[model samples]
Target chain A: MSEFSVELRDVVKKFPTPEGGEVFAVNHVTMQIKNGEFFSMLGPSGCGKTTSLRTIAGFEWPTSGEIYIEGEPMGHRPPYLRPVNTVFQSYALFPHMSVAENVAFGLEMEKTPKQEIKRRVGEALEMVKLTGMERRNPTQLSGGQRQRVALARSLVKRPKVLLLDEPLGALDLKLRKEMQLELKALQQEVGITFVYVTHDQEEALTMSDRIAVMDGGVVLQVGKPVEIYERPNCRFVADFIGETNFLDGEVRAIDGDRVTVYIPRLKDELVGTKASPVRIGEQVVVSLRPEKTRIIENKAKMGNCFSGKVLNIAYIGSDTRVFVDLGGVSLKVWEQNKISTLDPEAYYERGEQVWVVVMPENALVLHLG
Target chain B: MNPHRRSPLVVVSTALVYFFLYMPIVVLFLFAFNSSKTNILFEGFITQVGPTEIVSGNVIQSPCGPFHWFCELAKNVEVRNATRNTLTIALISTLTSTIIGTFAAIALQRYKFKLRTFSEVSLYIPIVIPEIVMGIGILVLFSQLFTLLNSALSLIGDSQLTLGLTTVIVSHIAFSVPFVALVVRARLHGFDQSIEEAAMDLGANELVTFWRVTLPTIMPGVLSGALLAFTLSLDDFVITFFTTGPGASTLPIYVYGLLRRIVTPQVNALSAVWILIIFVAVFLTQRLQSRQAY
Candidate 1:
């Protein structure tokens, strides 16, 4: 059992649709989660991130391909034999069971002695900081407390891995953030591999050791949280992970990792780092994050810059989102609160000429389609 | 007219229509304690005033008899045996049908297969078909087998074939399985499937998941369905009438036989008792259903 926590080799899951054909829920996807590592599958709804998690939990069986947990091939081995548990999105605590009973259930299944079961249940409850809630049913607990009970239930088993599918998604924003930190700390303290699934980009970014950005039943990229944010490999990944200004283009030149592409929308040539191979004259897409794109009052010659009219602008307290209309398309620039207040009226007005500047290296270009 | 007012004629008509719907049941229930011999008030056309007696707990005897409820019912050995038979058949049918049909419900809920829809539809066939037809069909089939091969068939021939307590129970079970299946099915549908999955993830095999999680959660449904099946079996006359050969008779069938001989005041008393028993049964069933909404 001492092996990588999980390994999925080309797993594909399809669900039967009512009108005849099946929907390819989880397309051919291969991923590995190291032992004791915190990994997350990040995506939009219906993107198969949750399905992948379910397959690992044995709630779903792949149409083809294999799933291995701790080096044992899971060939229709019902969930019970796989030393893994899931904290469901709804916190799926047994509504009829008290918090302590829920936590003690796994131990009781193991036929552990009563004294040890009670002691470990107490320990598990305390681990989640939910002491004295042993007898309270799930309804009596707040959303966060219920989530803790779910965590405690699985954690008491000390499974090889803990799979949490959107565990914090049901909580309010403040509670969600607090639980995110708690989950990370808990994972560290327990030292068990955790495979978390969530559609919240910021949640994945803040909590995961490694994040797999998925779209349309495919994993677009997988890397450390910072790597996914700072160097998104594709347009979908860039758009899904954070705010980005997309520009359609054709590859004008390719020289190793540095490529020059002409963006037809802005009628300009911009330099960007290439993540994948691209042929010359191929229709490609370039993504510049809103924060990376600078707005200057005067023309800047050192970086890629274009002058355009500010079609609209919105002040969001902490940042100003300025929409600069460049004829065929518009680009967004998030000016920090301090920088935005420096010239408030000049940007928020309509039809005001503005300079949209982008650092050459900060722009990310890729062949997403 | 004020706002939200209906016409005066419409209100009067509605009240008259409601009275028509309830007038008979109200009459029967009120006169269950009527102190007069006549089904209605005494033929003298006098409406008695009882600000005292039954309505207030004074010692006035009921109309049908001396509130002789227990001995009134126990005087006839035939009625007593019929009561015993009815209770026996209902209990047996409810227990057997609930166990078998709940397993069937579990299969339908847990697995996916071709021809599942066909099997599901077939489960309701017994319920939709005429009960009288089903009972008579079984009776005819069994009687022919018993006559043609009296010595050859032995397992059920001893008692079930002779149309006594055994035949009644078997017939009841046949008519009840489908209703049990349907209610258990709806309960299974509304069930949160994750309970089974959770059990498995916590180191339970298929059998364990079923025993530990699925069965306990679905118990209320099975129980309520069993009670319904029992009540239906108790009230069934047409089906029991056809299936019973010479000896087997349920309470309703016994009442029918009594009506043929004489509509004894005791029969009315028995009818009131039967209605009272079923009333409690229905009340408890409804309570069970409401408590299981979650």
Candidate 2:
């Protein structure tokens, strides 16, 4: 078998608009998911994440390209012929069937022995923590239980690759968080390649081993969660993945890996690392995370320190988010509340003059799409 | 006045509406047991038989006690034949129309083709047009087609084709198909297409997925549609009147003919039996549907 469990080679999917114009739902996208890897495609709605997952699952055929599952080329193969199953966002359980029956349906399709089907279905339900819900209908279960049933139904098939289209999207916040961790654990236990699609960046980051951030039918970056968050290659990825402050600038000087950008608003130069090569004099945006920037009293020791007035301070439990205005550009700085104190004077006050310092490595110079 | 309590006027109006709707049926059922042959007067219940009496120059007897008219209705060969014809036509038309209409609904709802819009819009035509017009149209079409076929067949031999139970059943199916299709289509509207995808993803092919997932999911709608078709066939009068041939008279046509000749308590007995059958059928269906609800 190939090292990659699933691969899409320049897959393009086009759908016709009601007005007779064609729109590319997935545009020239290529991705390789490694074996037993938890891979997630993260994007906003209509960003082709779900479309890419569907193509990999063989629910849809690419207009021009090919998909390979476990080294086998899938060309116009229907979903039933592919050894992949999907956990739909709606959980798409067979409402008429009981939980055990729903999980056994795949085995029955494979013509497995009845005893084996029953044992496998029981094990699958137990894996999803729904062992006792065997005889209950899908409509009788809660949303999260129904989601688990959907997971068991798909996982029971022992597919080479499992595609999840926002399986936890319908759950409440706490349940979604719990399921995210549970799904990551389940993927590890089953040793099946998981191709998850979600619009929620936090969920994707928490569950996926590697994430592909996409926008407008294109993948902007694919990397580990830390790499994606720390060194985003484009403005969309930086903005989409997490909260980041964008500083508009033009490239001034280029080093081997470091680049200097001149911000017209601040009338100062900011140095940051560049992942993709940037030409001198090219316009780019520097993405700086709020948590990476520090609010300090001493500015003499800092290299990229700017004295600014605090515009707003929001005291969230673990961190204090302070918005600092450096001339016309407003930057957010997150200060960790390490010391437990309820005193009002312990926190930075609004309109107070403070120095915001960002390390050179923390600022990411991204190409303006 | 209490906000939850209904006003006196509301209660009276509701009672009046129900009374208006069921009064005639109730009277007909009550008259089924009446001993009077004329049925214009409320004769006392004469369960005990005395000596044979002559009323209005005709001999009247209550051989079957209070169920005299029902027994007479059961004995009438013409009514029995009509009842058999009605049931056969209804059952056949219901089954055929249900299968055809379900296919039509699925095709219209799930597939896109060149004439999809036209087919969908035309499904409502049969339902919207007057039944009498449909009856007349079917009659004319059948007459013309049978004439053409008979003349062609005469060239070879003396084989012939004429309207009978076949024609009645065909007409019933024609009108019933649209209602069934519409009802089934309404059920299909709320169905999630992703369930079918899920089934296929689980290694079932198109046929298996349809049989296992799609059919079971939409079965309630199909059953309700079938029930509607069956009742429509059973209750149809205008279309049956025009489409039927000799010796193929249904219950409603037979009742109409009986009314034309003379009104008897046997008609009331037949109607009372019909009301009971319909009520039982509706009750059973309702119970089945509730039990099937998840």
Compare the candidates by lDDT and give the number of the best one.
2
Question: What is the lDDT of every predicted structure here?
Answer: 0.82, 0.90
Which tens-of-lDDT digit does each residue in A92-131 have in candidate 1? 6776678898898888899999999999999999999999
Candidate RMSDs in Å, in order, are: 5.0, 1.7
Clashes of each: 2, 0
B-chain TM-score for every candidate: 0.79, 0.95
Q: What digit string (tens of lDDT, one per residue) describes model 2 on residues A15-116?
A: 989898999999999999999999999999999999999998888889989999998999999999999999999999998999999999999999999999
Query: What are the models' TM-scores?
Result: 0.88, 0.97
For candidate 1, the per-residue lDDT at B287 reads 90
| Lowest lDDT 10-residue stretch of candidate 1 chain A | A339-348
Error of 1 at A272 (Å): 1.9
What's chain A's TM-score in each predicted model?
0.96, 0.98
lDDT for B5 in candidate 2 is 94
